[model samples]
Structures are given as structure tokens and as C-alpha cells.
Target: MPLVRIHLDTDRTTARRVLQLHREGRIHHESREAARDQALRQGRTPAGDPVFVGITNGRRDVQLLYDVEVYTDATR
Candidate 1:
């Protein structure tokens, strides 16, 4: 899959959640839909489209950023 990035304006809780997951080394969901759905509400794990959505159909390795911007874990 290709790597991409997105800037999201979010709160601390959500940012921390993503950061921790990134530290663990992967940001994944059952599917892109699940990720997109998660981000719909406040304080939820942010994901979807360019972030969690994979090009070839699979889980994406997402890395965390300060505050909250979403991008795939390029190092992986």
C-alpha cells in the first residue's frame, strides 16, 4: 500500500490514543469502515480513508503524531 498523511484538528485524548497505538507499532481496524466510523465521534480513535484505508485491501500500519494528524507508518 501507498503511504499518505492527513492533518486533523483533535483533542488530547484522541491524540494520546493514536500515539500509544503507534508506539505499539500498528494502527489497524477490521476494515476501513471501522476506522472511519471510529473517527465520527469525539474522543474516539481517528481513522479512515487515506489513513487507515489500504490500497490493496488489508490492515494499515498507522503512526501517531502530536495533537492529531493521521498518516500511515511509513517506516513499516
Candidate 2:
């Protein structure tokens, strides 16, 4: 299993929205899953996707960090 950590430079509001959406089950799984889907859809690996992870309020941007681990076999 490889552990992947993604750091998103976002504001507080965005992070809150992500948490809310995840809690509401409006999307499948965690925000990390959504991020992975979005990354993969864009032809990129979820482990190395460049994204913003936070909310921007005025001159401040509160960013959130995410850690995702994927278990895989030797074949993968």
C-alpha cells in the first residue's frame, strides 16, 4: 500500500464545503475520493494531482491537507 498525501492551497470556506458535502453524502466516499475521481478524469494520478484545498476569505486563504492511502498488489 502506498500512502499519498495531497496538500491543497485553499480557503476555509472551500474546506468547510468539502466537509459538508462529504457528511451529507451528496458525493460518494470522502472528499479524497472526489479529488481522485476528478484527477483521474483529467488524465492525472490522484496521488499527484494539483489542486486547491481550502477557502479564500478576503486576504486570507485557509488551506487544508489530505492524506490518502491506496493498497495495491505487486501487479499494480
lDDT of every predicted structure (CA atoms):
0.38, 0.50
> For residues 10-62, what per-residue lDDT tens digits would candidate 1 score against the true structure?
44554556555656767633333434443444334443253532222113433
Candidate 2 per-residue C-alpha lDDT over 1-76 given as tens digits, one digit per residue, 9 for 90 to 100: 4644455555566677876765665532455556565445544444443333333344675545554443343222
**Stretches > 4 Å off in candidate 1:** 1-4, 28-76
Candidate 1 accuracy as TM-score: 0.33
Which whole-number lDDT from 0 to 100 does residue 36 have in model 2? Answer: 62
User: How high is the lDDT of residue 73 in model 2?
Assistant: 35
In candidate 1 the C-alpha lDDT for residue 6 amounts to 30
- TM-score of every candidate: 0.33, 0.43
